[model samples]
Target: MDRKKNISMAVIKRIPKYYRYLKELAENDVDRISSNELSEKIGFTASQIRQDLNCFGDFGQQGYGYNVKELLAQISSILGLDKEYNTIIIGAGNIGQAIANYTYFQRMSFDLKAIFDINPKLIGLRIRDVSIEDIDNLESFIKNNEVDIAIICVPKERAQGVCDIITSSGIKAIWNFAPVDLKVPNDVIVENVHLSESLMTLSYLLNESKITE
Candidate 1:
């Protein structure tokens, strides 16, 4: 989809936010929301919201504004939430366990197929009904199973090595939680979640807000 490729990453990032807010609205029994109302809730201009949504296709009608549930479903499909993606988490540490235990991932269509770790104590253990496999069997498991994604929750020192192994095993996408930037081939896609960097940005914003006030 050349249209998808041409879309700005900022706009792409906002799609999840839109889905989340629409979910919240759905929960609150909001059946419909005008662009102006949506702007108030999401803090983006009505024009901007329309522009973002229009990038895909026209879903809004002249008089109906937007159907809340239908629009949510549309955004869900656009974000690839309509199909289930089987994923394996590569670490069983604190962060990894939290992700493993989170049922939200399942709701978002990311099925936790398995977990992998090098620690002898963790291997064969179960987290949220998914068994932890030894890292040694990772490649075999991946080959035998329909694994769509790999999550790297290892430490910085171990992150690159784990990433290399997983990528070499034919994994196309990786969600890396480790605090390191990984080098991957052109065919591989890596989304690094740098919690510290995000927190630092928040800190800077808070300080700036206080100064402005």
Candidate 2:
């Protein structure tokens, strides 16, 4: 199998925990580790880890294990954290401002390049060095710039429309924080982060705990 196609986001997401555990092992001078050992430390079944790794071809020997440093580098590159990605923000609201303020976004190789909104008051404003432009300028700006990702922070009612505009603007991936479900084209990737649902889940957990008590 093609190595790039073998490593997926599902497997990539688990790499951090695995890398942390491997780092600990490396600190102890453990040069190699078995699948079973990784499974034990990360609470995954040995077979599952093996299956994920199999996508990238067999990295372990029968009795020996994987090289910690090599596996870490492989996983890091797969997650795309090894290079910087230029990002744009749709909506210059409070939530959008907060995302712009996030240092981890830059630390993780995501650079905030610009912001967009329909509000005339916000248009031409600057936040964190990225000027807020009129939403009408989205297509031209995105086309001329190197924006690879869009962060949607618009109101729930406007989410879908805004997303459609963003997709039309040629952004392939979106990190959406709007309350509404976005309907974009098939080629576009939309990741919704519903804050209300998360809060409701916490509320349900608190209620369930009270019942048990």
Candidate 3:
């Protein structure tokens, strides 16, 4: 999706949270909801929600607020959740296996097509019903399959090389779990998930409070 120059990255990041909140509202049988109510529940200002959705065109009515199900459907379309993605996982380590087992990914339209690893023992082993293939056939496998995304769970040492291989193998996007930063072409999107950094930040926040106390 070509990002509009008008919308900031911060607003884009908040879309998922809004989607989650809307899903919760739907679960509670909410038919319609006001921006004020959303603001209180979502922790974002009503105007901010208005501003973000306005960028995609008018979704909310003046008096009616917004239809909960319709609004969620709109948000899902905006975030490309409506599109089906054929994804593969690189590396069959703990992180890779866990990601492969995440049913949430499939529910979100990211269907795992296969898992690849260099380890001989892991190769041909099935995790969550998807068999891990040899890394040697990774490129060729992508070439034949309708692979849209690659989940990188390899070690930092292998990440860059894997990035280059996958990006060149016709994958559209990368969800990198490796700690090392990866470089890719302008066309390929990369989302680096640094678990340890996030954990350390949480640790620091907790320790800072303890130290002050």
Candidate 4:
């Protein structure tokens, strides 16, 4: 497989959607699908689908289309779902608890190894069999464990502090839920899930639709 590097972020973002739709096709026992057929199901233009996939490698044949099962496996590997990631949540608040309770992440190979919080009452509590530890133990725990991702769900005011500890401990990736933007070394990757911003974006789209109508 001839894979290209520095692929645009727009294409990278669409890869997960392709993986999801391809998984559905595979689950239904669909053996093959042309770009146009996948386009109809996935809401992307056939040419766009072809172009996006070409960034990775030549996946489809001229007449044979794409093998559903094979494509799904390739996309899965592309998304790094083929490997296990040990994850720790740095806050045991509502968002943190909700994330911990979600078992689907484990299904995708993101293992929740621990949860940390400064709250005395939340300490020693377990969510999905993972005990919540005191924040003071965060650095030591990371040192002892091979943590691949750190989730920052602490309040905005404390998010950066928690992030500093995580990055300092050599964690390369972070899934941040705090509203504030975090600064980190260039090598560290942060994916922010700002709920309020998402809601406001929805609100804007709703108003725009009303105006257009």
Candidate 5:
């Protein structure tokens, strides 16, 4: 596994929260930022920000603080957003098509390169600006274009098989939205996104808070 990819996967998950704070700082014209200040803004402790920043090599001065521009650049590089990543989404169902039409990644540093489905009806259809491609074309497309990541939105039963095919096609990273947990080789990185789990967590928090009132 590429160490850069490993570090990036961890840091990319934090970009939104960090970016929000940085954007506020930029609006306020705050130049130098201590880790503590960054922490307060993001609801993390100053030491946590310092430690996370240290993972990509020191960016903050011992006494002063981190230069906003420098720190932003470092975080950007670590998250692998300095360059664009071409992504393929498997399964052209509702969620998949929704993701295809989403403008969030286009506004950020990622691009939705293609979509795949086994249904012949969907094979020729277009989602967003990108057209849906048959699963049979996945290997050729990935090989020819050098796709960086894949999104697995297929049914839980088919998720593992799709991931296997993706790995064989040379994609190293995956964003799996299936309900089941997937097993992959060490060389492949699978990020499982269980929306139900998140919603349940939120529900639990709200219920707990309500009891305290």
Candidate 6:
């Protein structure tokens, strides 16, 4: 399917939810489902689901709905899950270690090649058989290896410095876990996962609900 240019981020974000639900349906041996049925399960209105999917291409039939496995495969391809990404985490601290231990990323084709840290104690320590290397080796490692994405799990203070090292070493994509955002060249893409901000959002929602109650 030919992807249309300038798809809105809101629609892009919802695509993953579609993929997840479709994957679950596929796993359960579901053959086909109407958009309304999918809407009930995913909490999106049927019209909204159809519009979001139409951003990519025509999907599902008027009467028959979508073929579960086929739709899952299509969404997977759209999300680039079909390709493998060699990823490295800079900062073998708690967040870093947890990410390294998550095998689901590997199943999604994000291979954790190495982990880097400034701490000498963490260096040489292995998480899931991938040894944590010294921060000093980071540049050379990226230079020698085909590292596609750099995962920044370092402190906010050091996040930019590590990002600079990664970008200067010719890496274009970053999965930043640091609270602070990193400035990058126009060609580079940074996806930030700020844990504290997410927690704060949940806290705000919880308090808002309590006030309403």
Best by lDDT: 4
Query: If ranked by TM-score, best first, what sequence of candidates would result?
Result: 4, 6, 3, 1, 5, 2
Per-residue alpha-carbon lDDT of candidate 6 for residues 24-69, written as tens digits (9 for 90 to 100)? 9999999999999999999999999999888888888889999999
Best by TM-score: 4
14-102 per-residue lDDT for model 4 (tens digits):
99999999988988999999999999999999999999999999899998999999989999998999999999999999999999999
TM-score of 3: 0.94
**Which ten contiguous residues of candidate 4 have the minimum total lDDT?**
160-169
Which pairs in model 2 have colliding backbones? Answer: none
lDDT of each: 0.90, 0.83, 0.91, 0.95, 0.82, 0.93
Task: Note each model's CA RMSD in angstroms.
Answer: 2.0, 3.2, 1.9, 0.9, 3.4, 1.0
Native-to-model Cα distance after best TM-score fit, residue 166 in candidate 4, in Å: 0.8
RMSD of 2: 3.2
lDDT-based ranking: 4, 6, 3, 1, 2, 5
lDDT by residue for model 3 (1-213), tens: 333566778888998999999999999999999999999999999999888878776788998999999989988999899999999999999999999998998999999999999999888999887999999999999999999889999999999999998888888799999998888898988888999999999999999999999
Comparing 2 and 6 on TM-score, the stronger one: 6
Q: What is the clash count for each candidate, in the order shown? A: 0, 0, 0, 0, 0, 0
Candidate 5 structure quality by residue, lDDT tens digits, 179-204: 88888888998888899899999999
Flag regions of model 1 displaced more than 4 Å: 1-5, 206-213
Clashes of 2: 0
Q: What is the TM-score of each candidate against the true structure?
A: 0.92, 0.80, 0.94, 0.98, 0.84, 0.97
TM-score of candidate 1 against the unseen true structure:
0.92
lDDT of 5: 0.82
Candidate 6 residues lying further than 4 Å off, grouped into runs, are none
